[model samples]
Target: MGKHRAYKFRLYPNKEQEMLINKTIGSSRFVFNYFLSLWKEEYKKTGKGLTYNKCATMIPALKKSNEYSWLKEVDSIALQSSVKNLEDSFNRFFKKQNKAPRFKSKKNPNQSYTTKNVSNSIQIQGNRIKLPKLKMAKFANSRDINGSILRATISRKASGKYFVSLLVEEHIQELDKSNNSVGIDLGIKDFAILDDGTVYNNNRYTTKMAKQLAREQRKLSRRYEQAKKDGKKLEDAKNYQKQKIKVARLHEKVANQREDFLNKVSTIIVKNHDVICIEDLNTKGMLRNHNLAKSISDVSWSMFVDKLQYKADWYGKQIVKIDRWYPSSQICSSCGVNSGKKTLDIRNWTCECGVEHDRDINASKNIKNEGLRQIQSYDKIG
Candidate 1:
């Protein structure tokens, strides 16, 4: 069972060291985009695709001749890994069997680089990490990465904090048949309502930190105004950076809380259940409606689903996604009657056959029944 996993470590750095980390990230991104453009141009002109090795070989020569000669300060192997990753991305996008490759934009310019030989003595101490380039820096191990490291990503979030992610390979053992099975209906108000009548209340992770975030943001905005008034817009004021880090730390705290909660919930579910059934939600499309947008984003149903999926796969449990069009919530679980006209405001209702139901619980039950039916059908066919 070849599986992929990653372990994360929290990095702590002095101001100077932090700057170095930022520079490394920027240089890596530059190297990737630069090589990507060069390869793309060559392919357009000569009608020949560049392999990863060929693309990587061109980097040293280009860096010596370009404005980014500073990239030489970092590990050359890390830079090569970035080019190789770009090549992989292009291969996926331009495969004859796949759709056409699309253009890259600055707003979405690919970020992060990788390094092989990741399995060689990578450990977390109190507040530092031992990387190939930086030797030993300040970082703390956040989670146990269950797999061997394959790559690492360095990127900044919207809150302007730098983070490094380790990608790894994890293999899991098969699950036994006697484990539990469950169906879950996700909701903004309830978080998750299981078929077993268990209701996990929404913690509203973002909302809980809204006050502190707004306060820091206010400080940042005031610093920005002062900087503009001083006519030094190119360089943000010292106060601006102070406020920025404050805001980033707050956002990081919120994210940490959310991740912790999700991990606990996912771990519990995975441990108890052999098969998990969930709705195939169109979260992106659903986010378009402004009315429930805040609540929806706060819950992060998409992230929840993704965590459930890979974890389920790792645990050798089945995660079945009912079709997006499937009317799980609209159908009465007792008699299979369609509650087609049900609205979001309808929390509880009685079926035509006189069965009382809590809307989410009923939906979860219907989902479980349908999932079982499908599994049985598949088994019969097999």
Candidate 2:
């Protein structure tokens, strides 16, 4: 069996191509919203629901009957995919895996429809990528993709940056073999403290750009307020849309920067270690802490761990997630004594056993030992 893979490209489409992409995105949103509304109405009236396959089958007839000839402009497969996404969302909601369905807004929907397993190759000559509908565009890098392109989505961010995300399918290559293993402890001070005594400081991308972002946001807010007063707010207003794009571009820049950093860190750790251990953090609970809220969100610790886990799998390395309730930080790595009362501000402490411990580093060591013990126990059981 092959692995499903995905890659993203930062597209730099020309003006003409940009317009086409914008139109495609708008059309896709229309179709999705139209069907979603229709489905909701049917559910209320008939007490029955439409399946994605049903929706896909009905689209051509619906368009012909309704005189929505513009629907013909977008690829049929793309339309089917969009319907399938709705189906999957509903399935997940019914399964209690996700929240109830919500309406998509036109202001920031930033996505459109495209198909999978077709002639959807975006060429890369040097640093440029060729986008369908959109012409040749430049990118910062050409990812080593290993799958057929499924969807090509062009999006404009709050910072006015444009990007294309590609979903693909390919077999995953096995990772190299090694006996080395390492443990990771994630904390507020450092993003991760490894068992090998390395501390990767948390580079809070959003926090670092806070001041500049705030300035841009304030500008956007002022524009919005003025528009509200003058009744000048219309979706198609050129200046209003331009400001929205600016705000979106900033948010996008921060996200891109964070993703890049996480990818590099994950790649390095997976390549260097044969086994990795990390805590299963309760990110939702962590978000509730008022004092550390912004810092925690800016750290994107959960996303970092997610990247690490997936990259480890792709590289044939093992990743063990220690239970969140485990007192990795409170237990002494050397003496096995519980110091659960240690305050959060206490960065370092000397144990009664004369072991000097940096809180995070010590926690990392403890976590590593626990992971090793679990592995050994599993081996014994087998």
Candidate 3:
């Protein structure tokens, strides 16, 4: 009944610990890139690549050298994890699931390194967390974590904030059964419409802050252009770097706001319903229409679906994703008559059976009935 989960906490490290964390993150990135280059070179020459164990064993000799002796200053387990990650990347490439591994750059705003919990190297007590090399850094213990620690990934963000996400194995108790079921129709105007006529409006955070974001981005662009005209490396341009952080802060605010909204909505729906049904929307394909792409992206349908699925799993609820091609909107929920496709402008229509229907509400009802039918075909609970 136990599953692996990750809980992320904001970290407040002292100056010395912060320096060490940065060094560790850099070292891990370097290790991954170094091994990736070696593997690609070897494959080019002999049509073979180095295994993870081979790369891991070579770390000791690397740390002994003067050039890479700094790697020894950070946590060793993090280096091993780096090699392991490279192995996974190669595996995925060979499996045709991903592209070849690429080199990591320090210019990247986000950086992280994973380290395993060996012999109790990681621990949590009070509002402080014990990490390897950086021991006992204070963190925002907003929620209690009750589980056995497996590993921790420390990351630094563009806003110059550090965080740690701990992977833990634990049993999550299922929520009490609400005995309620509902279907959801996701749309651009209203984020979600339930079968029961409950509608959740799409609060477009991007449009709300569009003007401010454009202003800050203009500042960042000016700084970059000035640095380029002055013949200075963009990374070394103090003004540009400072402006980048300001722009990133604005983006961070929008992202946090969107995430908070999605989390609250998904949680509320899952906690109140036992069987949730939805269409398996082709959000990627929907983005191809330039006219509606901005609206679709602002709604963030995919992220909302992902949240619903996971929260449903945690709460022992069911999520039934109906076929994308199902003519939920075309079919009348009352008469079950397939009235041919209607254009987007036709928001309300009267069916041949003389039943008037709202586009989204009717589709949601059909989705719910279809989901129940499918569940019944398999002799499962609705």
Error of 2 at 181 (Å): 1.3
Give the range of the ten consecutive residues with the poorest summed lDDT in model 2.
109-118
- Give the clash count for each candidate: 7, 12, 0
Candidate 1 clash pair list: 3-170, 5-168, 127-138, 127-139, 128-137, 128-138, 128-139
Tens digit of lDDT per residue, candidate 2, span 251-361?
877988888888888888999888898888999898998998988888788898888887776778998889988898889999999967788888889888999898888
Local distance difference test values of all predictions, in order: 0.77, 0.77, 0.94
Query: For model 2, how many clashes?
Result: 12
Q: Candidate 2 overall Cα lDDT vs. reference? A: 0.77
Cα displacement (Å) at residue 24, model 1: 2.1
Best by lDDT: 3
Better of 1 and 2 by TM-score: 2
User: Which sequence of candidate numbers ranks them by lDDT, best first?
Assistant: 3, 2, 1
How displaced is residue 115 in candidate 1, in Å?
A: 1.9
lDDT (C-alpha) at residue 314 in model 1: 80
Between candidates 1 and 3, name the one with more favorable TM-score. Answer: 3
What is candidate 1's lDDT per residue for 1-382, written digit by digit as tens?
5787766655566686667666666666777777777777888999976788887777778669767678888767777877776777777776665554444344442334556555573444555656667666666666665666666655556455555677777777756665578999999888999999998889998998888888889988988998888887524477777777688778778878888888889878887898899999999799999998888888888888889988888877898888888888788898998957788898999888999999999989988888888899999999
Predicted candidate 3 versus true structure: per-residue lDDT over 308-339, tens digit per residue: 99888887999999999999999999999999
